[model samples]
Target: MSISVPQLHAELPTGCSVDRSGFMRRVSGVQAVSPISPPRSPVPLRLSVPGRLLAGGIGLGCLVILMIAGLVVPDSRGVGTHEQLGMPACGFLSRTGIPCGTCGMTTSFSLLVRGDLPAAFRAQPFGAVAGVAAGMTVWAAGYIAITGRPVHRLFRRCSATWLVGILLGAWLISWGWKIFVVVGGLVGG
Candidate 1:
């Protein structure tokens, strides 16, 4: 079978003629035919102002919790505030005598909230990053909540797989750094 497209004829002056070529494509026993491209869907619509405000409000609430936890709890000097909060100690540390990935996170965040950057990093680099991220989120979310304007669209175009991979990679790197810090401390002190 073959498909054909209609030809167009236009009137022109003498000796000025338009040449017409047959527009047909053979469709018999095609070995390698290019697949038809699917129509692209539009970007999903973003949340409205009030909807964004609601989301931001929830984020701000989480930030508030982090802030309150930071303020009310004191840094345990890498021991973490989990015990102070009536939580069990790190099981890995208790059994294997090695710090876990999140062992000093609470202490790191608390120290960071107290404006001790070096101490925070020494406590847990990832926790310091988490504290900073929480603060930034609080600020951005508050702005979105109050003004109803979308803040930076940095990750608007990021795919879920990319985002998850980035996050996991960061987590792994941070965990490795945490282990290195802990081992260095043990060796130095």
Candidate 2:
């Protein structure tokens, strides 16, 4: 059955009504009725040559800053020692005995800085992975800012099942590692 827009509006839940022109209108309330149109497909903005260049420069600068911070930072082994410096390890991992996934990240980064990839991997495999991910993220963000196109769109299109599976897998791996460490300590002692 074909129903008029106004008729559909009138049939809305209580306290909601429609205007004479068949648009949603609030008769008496603090909330104002604003008619919203369906979102249109975004058209690419025509940026000036200088504007594009400026964006590219800014992106490159951000990438440089990220790399400097990630690779040039000195390592220390004290709880809350480098808290003010935004170093990830000094906050929680040092205080707690449990080794976080990124626990030896600073040492890993330091090893990387000293051109010891093997040592970095030995220090913390997860940290090495994180460092690579962070580098890629910075590069992708910079590239997007300059080119106006996203480098990694896979995350945007990920399905719920894929996310669930990833989370479950990570949890299982972490739990298994913890169990192995505990069992190894018991056997050795």
After superposition on all CA atoms, how large is the RMSD of candidate 2?
10.4
Which lDDT tens digits does candidate 1 get at residues 21-64? 54454444545545699987565345687788686877778687
Cα displacement (angstroms), candidate 2, residue 161, comes to 6.9
| Candidate RMSDs in order | 9.8, 10.4
Regions of model 1 farther than 4 Å from truth:
1-50, 72-76, 157-159, 183-189
lDDT for each of the candidates? 0.69, 0.52
User: Which candidate's TM-score is highest?
Assistant: 1
In candidate 2, what are the lDDT values of residues 1-189, reduced to their tens digit?
Answer: 222454554356444566666666445665644669988769644455676566567657656644554555434331122333564543443455555544455555555556666655555554445556556665665665667664435587988899789756754564344334433443210
Q: List the residue pairs that clash in candidate 1.
A: none
> For every model shown, what is its TM-score relative to the native structure?
0.66, 0.44
In model 2, state the lDDT of residue 175.
39
CA lDDT, candidate 1, residue 176 = 78
